[model samples]
Target: MGAFTRYATAGALVLASLPVAASARAASATAAPAVTGAARADVTVPEAWGTLIAAGRAGKRGIAFGDCPESEMLPESLRCGTFSVPVDYAHPFGPRIELAVSRRAATGDAAERQGALVYDPGGPGAASITFPLVGEWSAWRKTARAYDLVGYAPRGVAPSPALSCRRPEEAAGTPTDAPQQPSYAYKRERIVLARAYTDGCVRAAGPALRHYSSLDGARDLDVLRAALGEPRLTFMGTDQGAYVGALYATLFPSHVRRMVFDSPLDPDARRVGYRAGLARSRALESRFGDFLSWVARHDDVYGLGTTADAVRGHYDRLRAEVSRNPAGGTVGTAQLQAAFLNAAFYDDYWAMRASALAAYAQGDPEPLVTQASPRPYTAKGDENADAVRTAVECNDGVWPADWRVWDRDHTRAARQAPFAAWAGAWANLPCASWPRPRQDPLDVRTGRGALPPVLVLAAERDGVTPYAGAVELRRRLYGAVLVTERDAGSHGIGGADNACVNTHLETYLLTGRVPARDAECAPHREPNALALNRAVPRGTGPQHILRGDPAPAGS
Candidate 1:
């Protein structure tokens, strides 16, 4: 499909919209050691770059000592250190890329400690300072409590030499998924921003942008392992983070131990763009249908219509209303698209949407405004987001390299899913306009070779990384087991009951055992009593709107 405008309409629950082309792409802490007096696992560098990389590739490990540079250290459980890795792995020592490393020493008790397990938070762009502190995520606080938790920023990311924009606040505003159509003028603005962002990074980051992909990032992780003094690498990845974990396993199979990949990214879909990018719209349409049913039952809450169809009609009219006029000239397509993108992620905003509907009906946009400009993280330069997003994605693989190819694909996808068409394309406008040519993206493929079993979890209908990706990944890795969350469909394992998922997850981390075979856990729909509009299940009722937990799912 060629790029077009994103129009949110009530169709057969799913419709395609055109997408613009050009845009391209795109931690934990440890605790004290349990055994202090025991001999430290002896790890020594051969003092030769070839020896080090070779041994690492061969799965013969090395010991990690204190961090590289004191200045870069994070004042957390894990002390910060830098290791010398080749700026380009092919040219070790020619120029060096600093691998920012952090480590929480073993609780000083060797017997109780299961060794170091490094966890990676996704973003290809989230700093990895408190990775070990993610015990709460794994349901293995006791088990992980013993191992050293470690994390490091990817190259050109924070905690490393970090790429730059003029300011950090550039990251503000809800990052509404840019739809894939040209009708939205924001499409053109986004392209300009992406180019400007890349220019700034090039000026500031120098040559670092060339080696910031998962290929090199995976290499950096190996270097982290060598410095930390571990026998093997144990890791956990979520969303796009899973891709990193999968690649690590592929590149350093012997060193991989007990990898737990949550919210699996479908690298296949990533290779063939339409599947992964459009899954959100498909998932949202299904979930929105559910929301409309709820809205119909709570007719008093939103007087749009009594039946689900009526509720949908209300939305259809609302979309057209906003598309043509917006709320009393206060809201526009960009603002409305942003709100819709954010709202579709969770249930916390039904009332907000209801309120917006009520207000828009009366020509007000405050409800929509509140959502359009959400503050999910500390804001950095909007330029930083634009740069970081493009730098990573554009470098990972060649996007269309041909806008015409992108146009055909997007036009096709939009006809099937109008809600996200333009917005999705806009999110990636940077790739289309990227200044650099991309290498073929890494496959992150793992053939049927038995690996030390790992735990892979996914919500069946996850909006970002579809559950099928988990299944595909499991088949790729020799012994990996995948557990499906039937009803949960967002990040953090769909934020479900947590009991069943946790029980299995903790067992794997604590005992190194896998479920008998690939399995599926029952779906945990947000109970009506616990329904909060957000993807996370943290706060219920109005409190839900106030607290954010389990961060939003990413593409």
Candidate 2:
């Protein structure tokens, strides 16, 4: 995994699994005919769902709140707690697991207080318990004040009996040296690592590994909604988190008040893992081009090249040098690729990344090493983040069991997107040997006229989720309005300080006003070193800074 591993590793699983229809339908023949455009009055909420909510409200087996573990970065007003849910929802009283949750109450006047606004921060594994704090400190402050910002560590994330595969001590070492061109030996080593990681997960989590799919996370969300006493959920899910929100809306259409999907995953591509991975690789290639152009524009500072091709040549040579001998005994070809791949996610890192690359080329590897440093685990359970990322993605859909298929697809992809194709392939290869039986991909297409108008935000050049995913999500969710950030490649759209995007987002969250038709926003000015340094909050890492967090202490 690399610096942007959480986002980049979100490729698809197997393409052969059956598709589970996620849309909700009226349970009675007497129900009115389905409406077309506006919110329908005909859809009926299931009685069983009502009964479940009642049981939770009566405190029979509902979530309980308590003081959160103290964190100076977080306000004392935030509440943290956990609730038990069946590992297999079908067996409601069988084996159970706890879901860690956090809530920041509305700061606005009680008269203007809206319901809770739940958020999922992209990675199938990204811990969200700290998202409320992120909102409080970023451009989302107004939205956070009006609605109680709700966050939860989806099953198998930190503080929730996380899914750990290997201990830090058991971590495998990657080859310090690689040939200029990828060799069969390199591919074989990658497969061995993938299989070893998969086996470790099987040993660590046992049968529960099969239950950590996105569908399962959506079910846990419904339980949280019931416990919170909210009639409907207002949600904002980014990246893979967008997949969870889409699935949730499809499963409980009548219970969705407002929704936003930022840099959304393509629900239609869930069954075809290779197709999705290829799309992401292409997007990465395009974004890398953008990065190259940016570097060329600032040739005075970097002194690498005056054109994109020249800069790319320098990059190629640097990569080859590192592959021949790992810089500082750690920065190999993979680490170098990871650092640059992360820079492609947000242009805010462009100057820093370019500076590091320049320094590395000048016989100084320390700066690049700092940029490629692994995010330290903040809690005992935090170590399982990657394991959960693997388990959820692997269990989500059927992956090609044959390595030949992966080999062929990634090989083809590398021709056009050499930067990320091979890296993404190895990152997702664990699914080929995942221990559990694969679950069917959810049919995220909403029933006509079922869901309310959802607001979709996307950067035209976003590589992680890609712009096309937002388009596909709009088609899947009827009446959804999409707001595209023209010429922008940043992955997270909301709260990124783009007035156009944030205005659209804030309007929808505050008053449920969606544009009559799809809209486009001009991209914000590109970040320069001076501006970025000023924009980034104190005491946060580069990743957290781009994620709109004020501090790096929380999940």
Candidate 3:
């Protein structure tokens, strides 16, 4: 069958299966995480929360909405505003910082409307305010019509109180890519550079650096929830935001209503040092295997190879050649891996990634060269984006101070998942010397009654936040139902037109019911591009460029 026909068939199957969604939920609930543990006779909010709620109740000031600075670029209906939140929650009346917030009122009937559905697209550094403007709106719009869609720029991110790192001119010349089989000299240089980066962030942000952790972001969410006048918080946190939401639920369980965590981070991994590294390494390796299969299937078109092993060998040879000699002194082995690794996360770009690789191998280096060049940092608030990405991760939990910890972990991980192991290590190296007190990773446990019925989504072959993390998160949050998109390749799974996943999401949002047990969404074959001579669709709008930031690769 043709690719279009295949996709249509998948759509039909997805639709035909929806009539059983209610029964499916019942069937799935049987397999869901045990929710019988956290049910205490006296479930209570902390003293801090009670105080904040009291303060909010007394103040009587509603959220102040104004013309969004980006309104000209956005649809007129989405309003934007800012509110002062304490730099430190403990010192509520002390130093204050502004938070950027945007809201799109519900389009559904006002009588049936739920409260605001706050969203965090998870970069820890990614501006949440941008989600309503640019993210996959249709996926949630069905339920969003009755509820306000709200997004925010967390502290130390763009347009809020953004943080900065005083990067030196010489620092700009340092190679950001992971050096393959580095010599002792190279290792020493890397250590020095990592120290410099950390120092620069400390110098630029000062004490503010300590206030940018995920825990702090969660607190900020409470403040936002109060400002919006919602009695309880309804949220959707993806990627790192999953950790943020998890922390919020742990810190203020009674305040949660409906929550959705997609492609979640393992709360356990976040607290310790380098544990997430292993998870990321394995995820990348699994994705690499998927890429190999794709290339093998299209050997007739690309002439790379007709077997998975042969395709992998061809790739290994190409990468090795590039490591020895970068093409046009731009696309090095690391650069090539970085560029195409995007394919492992989202199948939408596989055709382009493959075409670029095939072209590079045939001696035209422009495709790979252009794909690998770093984004120009001239965009507004780009430096702050870097600062927040580093600060939050560094302060969130203790990263081992000793270089040997990374050395041991990266060396072991590289042996198995070479594509991203060392590269990820170098990407997150700044945490080693971060000039802030390291908070111990939170032991985020969810007992039976600890939280509301949450929905967790995961793609089996996720490249950044691994599927294992999602499973672990589901188990920790007792009663949470996990929706797995089997063999789906995207880092974020909700963007596609998958009825199985969307039905669960909309149902849970509209009625607070989930599939009773864990469930799976059948994978749909990605639509293939036409021949090389056909005009390829250009990627438009704002794309997420989070290279060398906190994440493994993608969000």
* TM-score per candidate, chains pooled: 0.73, 0.85, 0.83
Off by over 4 Å in 2: 1-63, 71-73, 172-180, 269-272, 374-383, 529-555
Every model's Cα RMSD, please?
A: 12.4, 7.3, 12.6
C-alpha lDDT of all candidate models, in order: 0.56, 0.70, 0.67
Candidate 1 residue-wise lDDT, 158-236, digit = tens = 5455555546554444333333355546545666775676676566655556665665666677667656656577777
TM-score winner between 1 and 3, please give it: 3
Q: How many residue pairs clash in each candidate at the backbone level? A: 89, 2, 12
What's the TM for model 3?
Answer: 0.83
RMSD of 2: 7.3
Tens-digit per-residue lDDT, 1-555, candidate 2: 111111111232221222211112221111212223322221232222322332243233445667886642456887888776656644343455667788888888998799899888757677677767755465787887799888887777765666777775343233244333579988889889899998988777666677778877876776677667666788888888888888877766777889999888888845435567778888998999999998888888788888999889988988887778776666787667766876677676787778777787777777766555333433333346668878888887668879999988888888888888887887788999887566668677776668878999999999888888889889888889999999999888887758899889999999999999999999989977431111223335323632433322211
- TM-score, candidate 2, is 0.85
Comparing candidate 2 with candidate 3, which one achieves the higher lDDT? 2
Could you say which candidate leads in TM-score? 2
The Cα error of candidate 2 at residue 149, in Å, is 0.9
Q: What is the lDDT of residue 72 in candidate 3?
A: 30
